[model samples]
Target: MDLHFGDSEPTDEERAAVDALLGPPESAWEGADRSEEDLRWARGGRAARDRRELLLPGLHAINDRIGWISAGALGYLCRRLTVPPAEAYGVATFYAMFSVAPRPATVLHVCTDLACTAAGADALCAGIEARLGPGSGVGVERSPCLGLCERAPAALAIRAGDPVRTAVSAPATAQAAVLAASAPDSAPEEPPAQRAVPQAGDPSLILLRRVGVVDPASLDDYRAHGGYTALRRAFALGPAGVIREVSDSGLVGRGGAAFPTGRKWQATASQPDRPHHLVCNADESEPGTFKDRVIMEGDPYALVEAMTIAGYAIGAHRGLIYLRGEYPRALQRLEHAIAQARARGLLGDDVLGQGYAFDIEIRRGAGAYICGEETALFNSIEGYRGEPRSKPPFPVEKGLFGRPTVENNVETLVNVLPILTQGAEAYAAIGTEHSTGPKLFCVSGSVARPGVYEVPFGVTLGELLALAGVRPGLRAVLLGGAAGGFVRPDETDIPLTFEGTRRAGTTLGSGVVMAFDGTVPLPRLLLRIAEFFRDESCGQCVPCRVGTVRQQEALQRIVERTGAAAAADIALLREVGRALRDASICGLGQTAWNAVESAVDRLGAYE
Candidate 1:
C-alpha cells in the first residue's frame, strides 16, 4: 500500500472517523503485496462499489474528526475506498461545509440568512468578531439559514470531535458565548435549548400532539402513548395490506413534490428485488423550515417506528436517514431512539417477532442543499458528487446503490404512523379530499412566538399565522421556503393545502410559513435568497450554475436602483429565472428563483 498524496497526515481523530466508516487503512511497509485481509474486506465489483459508497461517509468522518480535509487524509480515504484521488479531491472541495486549507480548530458558523437576519444575526456575527478580536485562533464566518428559524440568529459551533451545536446561541447570549469559545479552558456550554411547546389553537392538533408531550429518548414512553401501535397494525395487515392502506389514505410527500407515498412504495415492492432501501429525507435544508428537526428531536420514536413500517411495506431490509449536518440535537435523539428500538426488538432481525428484518443507518449531509433531491441523495450515498441524476428510471425503479429505494421526507414517513394506527379512511377524512392528514407548519420570523404548529390541510395561512402569534402590521409571507413562492398579507386566508396553495400560485412546501412585517427589507431578503441558490447550485449543469449567478447579479442591480434601472433589471431577472426553472437539471435550480421572482413580481420588493 504505497500511498502518495501530500506532505500532511491525518490526525488520530481523523483516522478513527475514517476507519469507522471503511475499516482500517491498508499499511504498506515498503512494497507490500496486496494484503489478503484487505482483499477479503473489499471483494467483488458489488463490494467494490459498496466500499466506494463509503467515500462520502468516509470523507464526512474525516472532516468530522479533523476540522478540514487535508490532502493526506483525502488520499488515504481514496486508497482505502479504491476511489481515484482526483475524484475524491473533487468531492472534498465540492461542498460548502468542507474546507481544504488549514484553518482554526473551532469553526463557528453564524447564520445570517432571511429569518436569522431578521432576528439580528448580523449584530450577533459582529459581536462574535469583536469579542474574538484579531488572531483569536477561532474562525468565525457567516452561514446560510441552518433550517433553524424557530430559534432565530442561531450559530453552529464546530469543534474537533464535538457534535455541531448552536454556538453562543441565544439572541441575548451572543457576545458572552463567543467570549467563552475563545477563552482558556473556557467556552461555557450553550444553555440547554428551551424547546417550545406551542399548543395548536386548532383543537385537532395531531402532528404536533406528541412533539412536546413525549420523552423523545424513551421507547417505553412512546409505546405507552400509542407508538408501535402503527407497526403492530402494519404486521396485522401484511405488506400488501399496508401498501393498500397507504394508497387509500391519499398521503403525499411533505418535502414538496406531493407525490403519493403509497404508489412509490408499491412500485418499489413490485420490482424484482430481494432487498430494497428506505430513505427518510431528514435533510431539511430548505430555508425557513425546521419542522423536520422538531419531529426528529421531540418525537424521535415516531420517525423510527415510521421508517420500520415503511421498510416492512416496501420489502426493505435496511433504511437510511439522511440527516442534515447542522442538526446535532435531532441526530442525537434519533440515534438514541434507534438504539432503544434495536434493544427492544422493535428494529432488527425479526422485528416485533414478526420475521421482518429492518434497521436504520443515519448518514449526515455535508451542507449540500441539492442533495435533498432524491437522485442527488442517492449519488451522495454512493460516494459520487452530490448531483441529481436524470429521471425515467426513477428512484422506485432503481435507487440507493442501484437497487429499488422508496424515499420519503421525515414528515411523509411520520404520517405513516397515524395512517396505520387510525386506519386510512379515518386519516383521509381529517383533511381535504386531495391533501390528507395533519401538517407541521414551521412558523418563524417577525412573529411573537415562532415555533412548529400542526394543522389540517385545509387550514388557511392566516389561521396558521394567528396560531403562531403573528404581530400586527404584516407585510408579506414567504410560504414554503426559499424555493417556495410568496403571498401578500391579503392572501393569508389562502388554504394551506397542496391544491389550495397551487390555486393561489404558491406551495405548501414542507409547511414553512415565514411572516414578515413591514420593517424587514424585502430587497435584501430577496437578495439573500438569490445568493443561497447561487452558492448551492452544485455546478453540475450550465443553466443552474450560470443562471443562479446571473439571478443574484440582477437582484443586486435592482436593489441598487429603484427607477428605470431597477425596472430593466427586474425584466432581466425574470428572463434568467425562467431559464433556470426550465433548463436546470434538478429541483434546486428549477425552483431557485421562486422566492425572489415571487417577491419582485407579486410583492413588489425592488420596484
Candidate 2:
C-alpha cells in the first residue's frame, strides 16, 4: 500500500461526499448484511445512530472478517459511519487493536508505560533494537495501552504475509491438492512431551490454568462460575447494605494511599446531586503493579459488576473507567464487556428491570503518569493538562464536571463485588485488623517466577519471596514501585502487612515486590531509579523537578569517585531526599524520595 500526504483542501462537493460517506446516519447498516433472524435477535431497527456507539461490535466484526483492520478499511469506516474524521481518528488511535498505519511484516508492540518501564522495559527495548536494528521494517511501536499496563513492559508480536490474490475462472482441481498433500508432512505435530500430562508447579501451566487470561464466551459461562453473583447479592441487599458491608469489611484502596474504600463511597453517596459519578481507576501505572491489568484482562465482568454496584451504592447514574491508553488490550476487552452488558440490559437505564440506571464509558489517557493520581486523572477526564490540583476540595466534593465522584483503583473495585457477594466478615477474617482481605502482589525482577500473586495481607515478605522462587543469596527486595522503598535482605523476615511494612520504614505501596539476586550492583540500581525519576518528573514543582536531576548528578559523582570517601555523599543524598519529600507539590514529587531514602538507609555501603 502506498502512503501519501495531500496539501490541498477538498472542494465543497468533495467535502460533502466525504461527510456523507463517513456519517453514521447515512450508512447506518449500509454494508451490514445481517440476516433477519440476527437483526431480530439484536433488536435492530436501523443500525446505531452514533457509529461511536457501535464501535465495539464494528471493530470485532472487522477483525473477524480480516485478520487485521487495514488502513484503507479504517478510512472507509470513517466515511461509512458518518463519524467526524477527528473522532474516528481518536477512536482508532485510542484502541491498540486498530492499526491506522500499514501493518509491518512483523510488528512488535512494546509496553513502555510506567509499570513495564520500571521493570527494565527500557533495557528490553534497547535489546530489541540491538537484535533487530533501528529503522528496520520490523516495526517496534511503544503502545500506550495493551490493557496489560500492570504487566508493564509486555509486548505482542504480529507477523503479516504479503497479500496474495489468485484470479479464478473456476475452482482448482482436487487432484492438484491431493498431489501437493502427498509430497510431505514437514510441519511438526505436538512433541512427545505434549502427550505427557503437564505436571503441577510449572509456571507456564499455572498461568494458563489459574490466571484466567482467556476471554469467556458467554455471560452464562461467567455466571456458572461465580460471575455476577456479586452483583445479584449486591442488588438484593440494596445500596446502603453494600456501603455498610464494605465499611465493615475495612477494604482499603489498592492504588496507593490505602484509604478506606467504603469511606470514599459514603462521601460521594451522601451528596444529594443529579449526576454523581463512579470512576474505576484502571490506569495502573505504578511500576511493578500488574495486578490491575490481570483483573481487567482476565475478568472484566467483575469490574463491571463492581462499578455497577458502586453506582447503586452512590446513586450514580453514570460511571466512567479512566483507562490508560498504554493498555490497548485491556481497553478493547473493557469496551467489549461494556457493549455486552448494555446488550443484555445490565448497564443502561432500568438495569435488571430494577429502575436504577447506570451506564459506563471508557475514556483513554495519553500516557501520563500523573493521571494515575486521582485529581490529575479527573483533570484528564475533563480534557485538560493531566496535572494534579490541590485536594481540600477532593474529588468527592467536586469532580467530573463539578459532581461528586468516587474513583477507586481497578483492583480495589474488583474486590468490591466479592466483598458484597460474600459477607463482609468473610473478607475481614482473611487479613490483619488494619489491612483486610487478600492483596495481589506483583512480583518481578530476578525471581524464578515473576507475576501477579494473591496472598493474605499479613503474609511475611520472606514467604512471598519464597513463593516467588527467589534465588539463594538474594541481595535486596524493592518493595512497591520506583516510588517505594528498598528492603534489605534481613528485612525480608518482616510481615507483609500494611502496618508491618510501615514499621519497617516502608509503605506497602501498591504491593509490588521485586526480588533482586546479588548479580546487579546496588549503586547502579539506585542510579537507574534516580535517573528515571529525573527524566519522568513533570517539572511542576521545584524540588522534584530540579532535585531529581541534582540527585542523579550527585549519585553519578559518587559512582565515578568510588572509594572509601564516597560515603560523604550519603548525607547529601539524605538531605536531597528530605527536601524533595517535604517541598514537592504533588504525590509524584513527594513520594519520589521514598525509594532513595530507604535505599540510602539500607545500602549506604554502596554510596
Candidate 3:
C-alpha cells in the first residue's frame, strides 16, 4: 500500500506487463535497475512525462495480464509514466474493472441490471455463486448491464494469460457461466452481431443497411456495399462543404444531449486553436442501450469511415474512440477493421490518396459510466479519473487536452454517412422536419423480439413496440434506460423524437425502450435504478455523492410501503431529486432521479 519508490518491487510477470505496453524503459530512472547515469540526469523523466496519457493503457496491460493490478505493478507503471504513485493509484481505483488486490486469474462478470433482472438474473447469480464458491479458482462478480439486453442474463468471462482470453455466455445458466469462467478459451462462441439486429436484411434500413449483409472483416465487401463512398464525397466536397451538407441535414446527436452536430463541428473547425481533435464516444454504458455495440460489431468500417469524414470536417487529422472495455467482440471487430483500413490506405496519412491525412486510435475505458460524458471521457483518456469538468469552456472551445475537440457518439458519427451519400435534402426528409434521419432503438424486457430496431425518428412508440411484439398485459414502458423516465402502457402513442419526448415531459435518451408486463414488480425496479445511480456516481460533487445515496435509501425505505404509508419517503425523494438535478455538475446527477420520479408520478407505484 506504500506510495513510495522501493516500497515493493514488481514481480517478473508484473514488470513484463508494464514493459510490453511502454516498451522497455530506456534508462534506469524509468523503472530500470539503478545505474550510474540515472544519478547524473533525469532525461528519461521528461520523455516519460510526455507520454502520461498512456498511464491508463499501461494499467490495462498489467490488469489484463494478471487479472488484478498489484501495488508493485501500479508503482512501476507510475514510474514509467513519471506519474505520482498516489495519482496513478487514484486512476487505477476509479474504474470498476480494475482490481488492485490479488484475486483469481479468471473472473466472470454476470449482468444484473434492469433487463437481466427482469429475465431472472437474481436466480442466475445465486446459482453461479453456489457453483463458483471459495477455492473454485474462479471469481464471480455481479456486473451492471453488459450491453447484451437482447440476450439477457449475460455473463462475460475473462481469463488472464499471455494473451488474455474472453468468452461471453448470454441467457446464461449457472453451468454455462461457470464453464466460461473456468475455461474461457473453451467457452462457446458468441452469436454474430447480426443476431442483435432484428431488422438485419431490411432494405429500408439506413444506419444499419450494411450491418448483416456484408462481411465485417472484409474491406472489399464493405466498399461494394457503399462503405467509403461518404469519405469520397467528403474529399470532393472539401471540409467546409462537408460541414455545410451536415448542417443542411439537420442532424442532431443521438447521445441523450440532442445537440446539433453541425454546430459542434463548425465551432471546432472555426476555433483559432491549433490542431483540433475529434473524439468518438463509444463507451456504451447506458443500461439497456446497445445500439452502438451492434453497429461497431456488425459494421465497424462504417464508424471508421464516419470518423474520417468527421475529422476532415472539423479540421482534425486525428480521431480517438473511447471504447468500453467489456465489449470484447466489438473491440476485436473494430481493431481488425482499423488495421485493414490502415493497410489499404483508407486511414493514416494520405487517406484515399486524396492528399489529406487522418488516423484513429482506440482507448479502452475500464468500466466507468460517467466516461460517457464528453468531458469525463477526455479526462479518462488523459490518464485521470473520469470526472466531468464544468461547462462554459465546453468541448468545442477547450477540450481533449485543452484544444478544440469535436465529440460525438458512435450513432451520431454513423449518421453522417447517410447525410453525405443520400444528400442532405433526402436524409432530412426521412424523419420529421426537426428530427431528421433514422434512429436505432434498443428494445428488451418482456418482448417477443428483443434487439436493436432501426426506425425513422418520429415513429410512434406504439408502432415501434408492435414491431418488437410487445408482450400481453404490458404495464409500463421505460423509454431510455435507467436515466430516462417511465410511461404507462396506455401512453404508447407518444412520438419517438427529441422534440416529441420533450413535449411529453419525457426524453428519448439514447433510444432505449424497455418494456415491463404486469408480472414484473415496479417497486423493485425503481429500487434497482436508485442503486445503480448510487453505485455509478463519481462522488466529485456533494449533491450527487450524497443525493444518490440518499435517494436509494429513501427508495429502499418505501419498497414495502404503499399509499399514505409511502408518502413521507416519496416526499423526501422529490426534494433530494430536485437538489441533484439543480445543483449537480454533470448530466449523471442531473438525470439520476428522472426515472424514479416518473415511476412515482406516472405509474403510481406507491398507490
Candidate 4:
C-alpha cells in the first residue's frame, strides 16, 4: 500500500504477466534495465503520459494471472503506464474484485443479493465457508448479484494462474461450491446460455428468437438465423437515413433511462467534434438484472452487429463494450464472436467493403457498479476511478477522452437490429404508441420458471408473472432492481410500460421483475438492498457516501421493530433518502432508497 515505488521487485512470473499485455519496455524509464544512455537524458512526455489509460488493463494483466495484487507488481504496472503509484493503487483498490493484499490462489464469490437470498444464499454461504476451512487454498467472498438470478444462490470460482480458470455453480450446493473453489478446471461445464431463456424457440419472441435455437459459437449459425441483415440495411440507408429510420421507429434506451436512441445518435453524429467514439455499456451489475447477460451470452453476434451499426451511424471508427468482469461465459462468447466478425471482414478497417472503417475493443469492468453510468464507464475505460462526471456539456458534446461519444447498453443496441430490419412503422406498431418495440424482462424469485422473458411493452405485470409461473403466496414484486420500486401483489394489474410504470409509482428499470412470497421477510430484504447501495457507493460525493450509510443504518434499526417502535427510524430513512435522491451525483445514490421506501409505504413492512 505504499504511495511510492519501493526496492521490492516483481517476481519473474509477475513481470511476464504484465509484459504479455504491455510488451517489453522501451527503456529504463519504463521498468527496464538502466543503460548508459538512460543516465544522461530522461524519457517521458505526452506519449508516455497518454498511456495512462492502460493502467486498468495493466492491473488486470497482473490480477488475472496472480490471485491478488502485490506492491511490487503494482509498482511495475504503474511504472510501465507512467502513472503515479498512489493513483494506481487508488484505482486498483476502487473495485471490489481486485485484491491488493495476499490471498489464496482460488476465491469463491457467493452471490448474497436479493434473488440469491430469496433462494437461501445465506445458508449456502455458511455451508460453503464451513466446508472450505482455512489453509484450504480457497477464499470465500460474499458478492452482490452475478447476473445469474434465474438460477439463484450462484457461486463463481476463479483460480489464478498463467491463464485464469473459472467455474460457475448456480442453484449451488455447498459441496459443489467447495469443489468449484478447490478445482475450477474440474468442475462440470456450465449449462448453455439458452437454458436461461424459457421461451427461446417461440415464434412470438423478437429479441430472443435466436437465443436457444442458434449455435452461439458459430458465426455462420448466427448469419443463417437472420443476423447481419440489419447492418446491411444500415449500410444501404447511410448514417442520416439510418438515424431517420430509428427515429421513426421510436426506439428508446432499454437501460431504464428510455432516452430516445435516434436523438442521441443524431446529436453525436452531428457533433463537429473530430473522432467521435461509441461505447456499449455491457456492465449489468444491478441486482436481479440479467437480461443483458442473456443477450450477450446466447446472441453474442447480435450485440456485435448492433454496435457496428451504432458506430457507423455516429461516424465513429471505434467502439468499446465495457463488459462486467464476473461474466466469464458471456465474455468468452463475445470475445469469440468479435474475433470471428473481425476475421470475416464484418469488423476492422473497411467493414463489409462499405469503406466505413470501424472496430470494437472489450474493456472488462473490475466489479464497480457505478461504472454502469455512461460517464463513469468512460472514466473506467480511461483508467480512472469509476466515478460519474457532471453532465453538460453532455456526452454527445464531450465524452470519452474528451471527444463526443455515444453510449448505450446491450439491450438498447440490440434493439437497433429489429428497428433497421423490420422497417420503422412495423417496429413502432409492435408495442404501444409511446413504449414502442418488445422489451426483455429478467424475471426471478418465487417463480417456477424464472428466466429472461421477451414481451411487448404493453403486457401487464400480471401477464408477465403468469408466464413466469409465479408460485403461491406471492406477497410482493420488485418492479426494478435494488434501485427500483416494489409493488404489492395486488398491483399486478399495472401495465408494464414506461409511462404506465411511471404513473404507477414504479419503474421498468432494466426490465427487472422479481417476485417475492411471504416466506421471505420484507424487512430483511430491504436491509440487504440498502447494504448493496452502501457498499457500491464510490464515496466521491458526500451526499451518497454519507446518505447510503445512514439509510442502511436506519433500515437496520427498523428491520426488527414495528409500528410506533419503528416510526422514528422510518422517518429518518425518508429524510436521508430525500437528501440522497436530491443531492447525490449519480443515479446510484439518487434511487438508492426507492425499493426501501416502497417496501415501507406499499407493503407495510413494519406495521
Model 1, range 1-607, lDDT digits (tens) per residue? Answer: 4435766665666666677776653443211246767545544434444578778777777777777888877866765666777788877787778898988877788888889988877788888888788897788878887877877877777775544333435343466557545542354543333344477333456766776567777888888888889999999999999999999999999999999989999999999965789998988888988888878888899999999999999889999999998887788898899999999999999899988888999988888888899999998887888999998789898888878999999989989988888889999998899999888888899888888877788988888888778899999999988999889988888998888988988888877889888889888888899999989898989999999999999888877878988888888888898999899998999999889878876887765
List pairs with backbone clashes in candidate 4: none
For 1-607, candidate 2 gives per-residue lDDT tens digits of: 3332223333333233333434422222343335665554543233333434444334333432343454445444543553444554554454344454555445555655443554566676676666666555566665432434323445654343222111110011222212212221221221221111112233433212223423433555556656777788888888888999999999999887989989999998998865888888887766666677666766677778889999999989888888765555577678888899899998998898888888998876645666788887776665344567876888888887778989898878878866876689988988899999878787776666666777788989988888767878777788878789988888888888889988988888888887766666677667767776776576767888888988888888887886665667766777888889888878888887787777777766463
User: Positional deviation of 544 in candidate 1, in angstroms?
Assistant: 0.6
Worst 10 residues of 4 by lDDT: 186-195
Candidate 3 has its poorest 10 consecutive residues by lDDT at 1-10
lDDT of 1 at 224: 86
RMSD (CA, angstroms), candidate 4: 1.2
TM-score of 4: 0.99
Candidate 3 has what TM-score? 0.98
TM-score of 1: 0.93
Clashing pairs in 1: 180-187
Candidate number with greatest lDDT? 3
Model 3 alpha-carbon miss at residue 155, Å = 0.7
Predicted structure 4: lDDT: 0.92
Model 1 local distance difference test score: 0.82
Q: What are the lDDT scores of the predictions, listed in order?
A: 0.82, 0.66, 0.92, 0.92
Can you give the lDDT of residue 124 in candidate 1?
84
Q: After superposition on all CA atoms, how large is the RMSD of candidate 3?
A: 1.3
- Candidate 3 Cα errors over 4 Å, as ranges: 192-194, 562-565
